[model samples]
Target: MESTQVHTLNLTSVLSVSKKIILTRYWHFVSLSILLFFPLSFSLINISSIIHLFTDDHSNNHKLLITYLLIVYILALCAIGAISYSTHHDFFGEPVKFFDSLKSLTFSFLPITSTAIIAHVIICLISLTFILLVGTILMLVHNLGFVVIDYNSVYFMWFLVIMGVILIAIVLYFYVEWSLAFVVVVVESKWGFAALMRSSYLVKGMRSVSLLVMLYFWGCGVLIVLICSTNMHAIVITTLGSFFFTMFLLRITAANTVLYNYCKALHGELELEVGEGFVHEYMNIPSEN
Candidate 1:
């Protein structure tokens, strides 16, 4: 009987520890939930846009595309900036409410959005260079193959490009995980240039944790997109869903908080040092430690 009681106690403790870990990690779960909501909303909106494009006359449809694209870019830039700020605010354990996020983003997001645009430009340049180089080589290959009566390979080339794009996207997710938080830091600190460097320092030894956090959200995001795409015809019903998403749906705070906590744990185990003023200025609370 005593032995049986001991086993029950052990099982209880194990379950308790597991629950604690999940509760502590609940922030990431919330972030994933927020992320899932947005894409599902956007996918629905985009599908509606596409349905309209198909039904409308060519001129009107073309204008619609342009308008949608412009709105998407602006929204994307602003959203990126907002997320950057909000995520960092979450990082320092500061309360990152939805309205506060909106206000901070509305006021200061342009700078970070501009920074994001610059980064995107640099990415575009690199992509352009790669395309030019690769195109030249492919052209030469095709020209030489033409002598052997084999000039066309459009299908294979497109497939290769598609695969390369997917690969690059995966690599970029891993690369930008830390920098996502950098935007918020920059806005709050008024040290835009140094934000990336500071992010590097913060994430120095937490690459694996960052990668896992990203992968978790990525999986959730893809799943939500897939589910939403199935019933895309309903998107044309109303724009209310998309509006709700942009205004309130997206929340990456919890995942960021989880990552921060993970890093904090690592920081303790590894004895990594934090900046002395980090808690006072960025965190906005007395340091628990």
Candidate 2:
């Protein structure tokens, strides 16, 4: 929870980022609140099943499970956009109803979210390829007697482990660098890959700040995983874990949206489109039947 203080666009530290996450009166936006609450409820109802899916590796539906997870991830991104948009709107003095945010999300935001997800997936695949290539070369060099290093040595094993960590860190760096694409799409109404390019551009020169925020999210995720792993059978713990995880995710979304707006302001590109939500509402207003 954040103390009640007016926030500024100058995000110079993690404390500033935390303020963005904590200061939002997200509960005031009823529609967005309901959208967030659904995840908690769903988690509670399906906690046992979800636990089984991960803990019981004997389940043979790997393809189906992967497909389901992908769909869920995309939907979660879209939801994040909606929640963040609502938060951003409030910050810009244009507080909007949930329906307005939902309208924007369904009509425009989904494609942007999908594109960002696809771009991220492609990047991960590339990173994995690079890691594999390096490993293969190392193995080949050892196998062909071109190097004196033994494959089974502790030092060689540590070298491979260190290389894997370095590769993961490189991937995480880009992940943070492009973290704001979803918010960029919702705020600027950017389409397809444009959102991604915009995110990269806005995040330029601020990768360190973005990385700090990313680390907080990573920490939250690690905490949730640890809690879930240890308390799988404790219903109360599981429920609270789901609730906190959902809140942590929403907080990250809020932080990203704030960071995006700040970057825009820094570059003199903070065009928030006042009443954009109102325009959505007008368009969504149905004729009397």
Candidate 3:
């Protein structure tokens, strides 16, 4: 009975276990590299966006925003891939090199990363379209310009607002569930939408925990940056703010990678080693420490 109880207690939630792994010195160095590399990468990527922002044509600002998003999204995927790949190396007690992780972005990683970014952009467009539809209906109703029946329009506006909130909530949940797709892409060498499908599969029954972990880290990072922005010097704020934000990203990536492994373990899928390529044959599942 005591042994059974011990076995049950050993199966702690992945978040709790992963928190320990992410904080270790081995992973911290990899995360630090990511934190340092991000700003330099962002500056290079932002050149075109800054040029667009300063252009005389304010009417094309929407197009500029889309262009900026495309640039940022592509760079963000590469950064994520680099960081997550490095963490995977350290997780398995392998010798981790920065360039090796960057090189690991080949195979299914880049394609899946591109696909995930495109999918996110699509989701944003769909959400924007819904918002526009709501605005259009409101406009048409107002143009009808009913005086006595204006109360009906007001009520309908409230309903639309509520619907907008609900739609946002649903999208948030969907995003959370699919958040680990990149990790799956790297680990399993899955291509394109297939990686997303694998991520959706692995995230089953874990959405609440995933959402909470993300919010906790991101909220803390935002709060720290906000405080620094208010009270610190510009240089201090820029340096320290970026540090905290990068740390948050690093930790989140690590935790999600750990979660991915745990889910694969649960499903009896073979675990990929740090330097191992994807193989079809299932190996015996190892006991988790």
Candidate 4:
């Protein structure tokens, strides 16, 4: 009976923490946060088009978009890199001035700058492979019409291939989604080896919360796109995609801040160890939250 009571309390605590996070708003930093992600998404979509262009040659002009995409992507990365040291500002759940926090975030990330370079390299390699794989798939679809009865018709191969693609999407989603926490680990925690692992530990039981947060951001992004589309689809797509990516980055940044604070406290780097009753303390808002 005592153990059952403990279990109920634990569940209640998790729910409360999740609710607290959801209720909190960061309207002040929304635009800056969006800036963090916009270029990367455009770069990705542009890469896809570039691959299709090379393989099909049907839309040769789109190569220009790819060039623009890569150039913009590189510039955005450089901008983030420039400000990487300033990402660590937290004033107890209160709104922070963006420039001040940006400065802090950059300094906080200094310890892992080299590691970040390595990670970026790995991602670039994977992106190249991904483009190649996408090109291969497109080539197969165009040359080998064995799976199609009519131009728009599909046979079993089409369904099977579609299923395969959906499965791949699910895998990619989980892979990227989980690692979103790593950047936080990179900056706020000084220790290199333990930073990423610490984030993984903190995020361990919070997968459901993370997924819901991602979904909410995605939906909000959709609404923004709709609003912007009323003016111009191209402009709105660019704006909406950027907004979604920025929010995504900010959430990762915020989640890492919370986790790093908690772990630092646990490791005696900070003054307290915040656990199940973490939020009940006065300093919870000041130091831990």
Candidate 5:
């Protein structure tokens, strides 16, 4: 029943804590990574192959793409669920076990999957809506004779570039807001829209930190993709890329779970505790909020 007070955490602190936790529970995450992330990494590393399949065989491409998406989606959910569960328990000074983390997934998998689907659908809808709105505005301007249709015009190109940047910003905004939805589903037992809402609420004061954390991991992912794509025929490069990608997946999930705890503590929703020896050094255990 003992608890430690949680304090505000920035991007550096969050990543630092995440790294420490992974180092502390190194084997548990490694096993989970091998079980779930290793296979997922193959799909990521061979993404160019899938694109080649698209050009070579249109009919079979659809089947392969669909099957691939399904398998990747399931594997991703499993990785997130197991990592989130283990990280949460470990964050609170509880014992963490790989098998127990896998078993905990039976209860969390459905909820986290539902939340992910809901978040994905919502993001897609938002994107479509933004595109439609932009199109409508462009059409209106065209009709009003404010701007003529000139694809090659520098002004028109700048306008398009501005719109694209705005769209990306909007999408990233929502992404950062709901980045913790799966963690919410796993830790709070909330699902779908409820989890999304909770994540948005929790991430309010910490959006910048979340965004930076996301961008760091995203940049690493992009780097891995570039290495794999450029060295498609190199088995060693692909394998190494997959291993680093798996490590990134584990770290990002752990970072998100740790951020979730910090958010909860910031909002006075949950009390958190680090393990012995590290608690006093890294966290402030206030008597009360």
Candidate 6:
């Protein structure tokens, strides 16, 4: 928890540190992933079944869908909390035990879950507001005869495309800003809006790195979805896909935790000690100037 200096890490360094921690503590993370992520993966893989349950006519299916969703949500929260806690410890060169990580969740789980829910709600609201605002603007323009807002017109199509890009940019901006909220919750015990605000503050001046980190994992997720979609009925393929997806999830969680520390160091809020073990482990990597 103590260090002599803070190192400013680029995206490569952030990922390098994450990789090293996972490699060194491979078994510990695997155990945590198994306890939390394995079931979560199973739940995610059966998402189509859950969707079918929702559309089925039987009241029993409704109950099953609700129950399934609740379980998956809890598992997702636990996975995030556990991985965040373990990664924080490992990154700091502190002792990281699987059971201790779970035990720490007794205090952290609620806060982490609350922060996650709040973040999702805010993102949803932003998307909804954007859609509503665009709809209203289009209506007013049509009503005022500002232009012939023909649905099939090339201009209208271009307008929609432009709006779509802006909306995506807005979402990506907030996503990068709030990317560290879960890590903030686990590490700082700040929850809900507070954690989000703290994340925003920490991520300042580092939005580009945060965005790249987010996009990298997001691309991996998309690739996993593609693999799973193509081989849904192939048990071996599905299982392996789910397993790698879970691993990437863990890696991204760890990367975010490391990024959080890097931000703290950059801002002079923390002095992050690179443990001797970490240094020796990656001694061959050229030093940053």
Pairs clashing in candidate 2?
Answer: none
Give candidate 3's TM-score.
0.69
Q: What is the lDDT of residue 99 in candidate 3?
A: 62
Compared with the true structure, model 5 gives a TM-score of: 0.89
Alpha-carbon lDDT of model 1: 0.48
**Candidate 3 weakest lDDT stretch, 10 residues:** 1-10
Quote the lDDT for 16 in model 4. 39
Write one digit per residue (lDDT tens) for candidate 5, span 88-164.
87776675778899999999998988888888898899989999999998899889999788878998899889999
Clashes of each: 4, 0, 0, 15, 0, 0
Per-residue alpha-carbon lDDT of candidate 1 for residues 1-289, written as tens digits (9 for 90 to 100): 1222222222223223323333544454245334434544575446655657655765455666666666656655555555545555444445466556656655665666555555566567766776777668768876877534233568776757785896587447535544434343444444344544445555655555455545555555455555555655575433444544433333333344334433443345212323422332222212121
TM-score of 2: 0.76
lDDT of 2 by residue, 74-119 (tens): 5566677677778677656566775777777775566676767677
* Residue pairs with backbone overlap in model 1: 27-254, 28-254, 28-255, 85-184
lDDT per residue for candidate 3 within 1-289, as digits (tens), equals 1222212222234445455555555454444445444553333324344455656476555666557656665656766676667666555555466567767767645676676766678689878887888778767777887523354577767886798897888788777868788887777677567777778898776666668777777677667656655644465655666566666666677777766765555554534441365321111222245
All-Cα superposition RMSD per candidate: 9.7, 8.8, 6.8, 8.6, 4.0, 3.4
Alpha-carbon deviation at 220 in model 6, angstroms: 1.2
TM-score, one value per model: 0.57, 0.76, 0.69, 0.48, 0.89, 0.88
lDDT of 4 by residue, 88-172 (tens): 3321333445566455545544445544555556556765676677657766986897543343556646855775686556544
Worst lDDT run of 10 residues, candidate 4, spans: 1-10
lDDT of each: 0.48, 0.64, 0.61, 0.46, 0.83, 0.79
Candidate 2: what lDDT? 0.64
Per-residue lDDT value at 26 in model 6: 93
- Poorest lDDT segment (10 consecutive residues) of candidate 1: 280-289
